[model samples]
Target: MVDDNKFKALVNKYVELSDQIAEVGAELVALRKKKDAMGELVMQVMQQGDIQVLELTEQGGKLIRRESKRTEALKKEHILDELMLLTGNDATRAQASLEKIHNKRTLVVKDALSRKR
Candidate 1:
């Protein structure tokens, strides 16, 4: 009886926490959209003005524009093609081998509570 009660309490706590997290997640998505939009606007304004640093005396800070370069992401198709080359251009065998490796990977499971609509 005690164990059952403890389990029930934990499940209730989990649901409550999940609800709070969901609310916060929605707010975070909205905030990120706004931030991205503002960043785009700032980039456009700085580029138009040919400005590197915008000093705000009242705000006591400045915005600096910096450039960055990075390579593209390593996609699944690229990896599969490389694997096919290694497997002597045997696409089917390579795919099967990859699937076997994927299936052998360890997975962790935990108890979770969700609200039913």
Candidate 2:
């Protein structure tokens, strides 16, 4: 009782949606780049003289600005060195154990012949 025409239409729609997702993702990256540039300018202005908050009045709200320290993560080589020092395990064993704990699964559907260089 499956309608072949309907199934074909659904497949085509799925491919179209995947294409739309790629387009939107690209747009989001572009927007984030612009936002980061603006944020850097704001940060430089804040650091030059201001020591505390600067509130900007808007139509119905305010923009608060402040600074705080962000934690810096150790690099891969440093982390592995520490792990080996603490656990007495070599790189290969540590990686295998981490892989077992970190593995997860997701289902992916790709358009036929869509991936290319």
Top-lDDT candidate index = 1
Residues 41-113 of candidate 1 have per-residue lDDT tens digits of 9999999999999998998999899898999976668778888999999989989877786678699999964
Model 1 alpha-carbon drift over 4 Å, by segment: 76-117
lDDT of 2 by residue, 1-117 (tens): 659999999878878888898999999999999999998887778778673466555655544565579988745566566666666777777666555544543658987656332
- Give Cα distance to truth, residue 80, candidate 2, Å: 4.7
**In model 2, where do residues sit more than 4 Å from their true spots?**
66-76, 83-117
lDDT of 1 at 19: 88
Alpha-carbon shift of residue 55 in model 1 (angstroms): 2.2
Model 1 lDDT, residue 16, Cα: 87
Clashes of 1: 0
| Highest TM-score model number | 1
